[model samples]
Target: MNQLGHLKQFRSSVPRKRSMGRRKIEMKTIDKEPARLVTFAKRRVGLFNKANELSTLCGAEVVILLFSESGKVYSFGHPNVNSILDKFLVQNFLPEENVPKIMEESVQGTKNSQVVKHEIMTELLSKVGVEKKRGKALDQQREEETLLGGEWWQGPIEDLDLPKLNHLMLSIHGFIELAMAKANMLTLGTKNGCK
Candidate 1:
């Protein structure tokens, strides 16, 4: 029955504000000349920006050509359109059926190798995620190494909590198994003849 109660009541009574952000634009032609021109400029800028991002982030070569209502040409390319066009032309000069390609590695053998893989782009993005996880694991390992002054072998079995003890047991089992395997391999030769 005080100012706090009044303030809470007042706050509850007030309506929520609407979001002032981008919304869906109508997919119809603008009849007005000025409006159309403005829209074209804005859309062109957005298109070019996206192309630049695609080129930069994915290490892709891209070329975009746009024409205005008045026949003015607008173009955007990462490493110049002419070079890309030339490469394309050289690769495609002979018809696909006619040309017998020699199975030689590319001079820039990076992107060419991945072209035949299933969902290569998705794989590449997944690799980024894996690298990020690996980087975090590496950082954590470095911190632990700094704290322990070497590989983290937890000491004083009694000091370890239940989960830590369980983890330690698992690690010990793995080490024993690995040692046993190496001992067996040393005593007995492998199927492929161990190097």
Candidate 2:
């Protein structure tokens, strides 16, 4: 028997530990301070490594800003942090001092601007969308009216179905309402209602 064959036989004698594969971490706040700090340190290093890889491999500008619970700051930047921040500030407004404030009012005022701007933009967009839908409905109504050839009252009504006759009756009521509203306005305007 060879020494190599004996070594192979010895390897087959050893047991392997069974595992259920990698587990997905539940995304929740870590209540334990010590574990959280350790996790932060590990994750921060990994994040920085990824950022460095992104810069080196893709030749892209990368900047990361992180604030720890202890008010410590951690940052990763390609080339420099200041240059990227300056470029960002040129595009968007930022405070004179970028430090976090303890004052609720001061911090809230800054935060509120972004929230308000987003809310206003969303509101205006919804209004414009509603206006567009209303315009489209009006256009469809106009097209349907055009298809019926100008005026329904002037068109042939003898061939119309019961439902169409009911619709025409409603339209006639609408016209009566309009005329009455105009008459009422005129009545309010002058001594004599109509002359």
Candidate 3:
């Protein structure tokens, strides 16, 4: 055979090695502290970049507060974290009349508002804890489904019967309504001193 034919035969005989690159990681808690730390660092940067892009692209304000396993705080904001937080608090908690005065007061003496800030921070942290619990529960449910070799919501939509579809729709609608009611109540409570 000619050299070209021999080269083709040799290439066919040699098994091509798979690409040596990062493998997909399963969604789970990383057991190793060092590996977890590294992953957190990398993913945190990625998350911040995505947040920044979203803010820029959508002309939306964004604020991210992250706490590492070691309790180190990392934050990112579009304009300024304090400004965004102030806007959120003003819009959600403080009355329209109190906004300017409160801002002025906070600016005049940081110590004067420390207690109020602390209380607000505590409330926000509690909310975060509640959200974390909810997320953990969802994660646990997904894990259980995976272990059982089935995901409830992953199959073809056309496969669902009408009753099943209607039940799912009703369940989702109820959930949305309940969540909205809870949110409205929380907002009212915050407006009324959260007592």
- In model 2, the runs with Cα more than 4 Å from the true position are 1-5, 94-195
Over 1-195, each residue of candidate 3 has an lDDT whose tens digit, in order, gives: 999999999999999998869988999999999999999999999999998987776666789999987889899998867677776787666658868866875676676565666677798789879967866866786688689987656688788889647746865886896797689768755553422
- The 10-residue segment with the lowest total lDDT in model 1: 98-107
Q: Whose lDDT is greatest here? A: 3
Candidate 2 at residue 141, lDDT?
72
TM-score of candidate 1 against the unseen true structure:
0.38
Which order, best to worst by lDDT? 3, 2, 1
Q: Write one digit per residue (lDDT tens) for candidate 2, span 1-195.
A: 799999999889999778989899899999999999999999999999998987787666678989999999898888876555544443333344532321232335565544544554587689779967866875687689879777555668897779668767766776796797687656533532223
Estimated TM-score per prediction? Answer: 0.38, 0.42, 0.51
Angstrom error at residue 155, model 3: 42
Question: Candidate 3: which pairs clash?
Answer: none
Model 1, span 23-99: residue lDDT tens: 88889999999999999999999999998887776666778879899999898988875455334433433245422
Rank order by TM-score, top first? 3, 2, 1
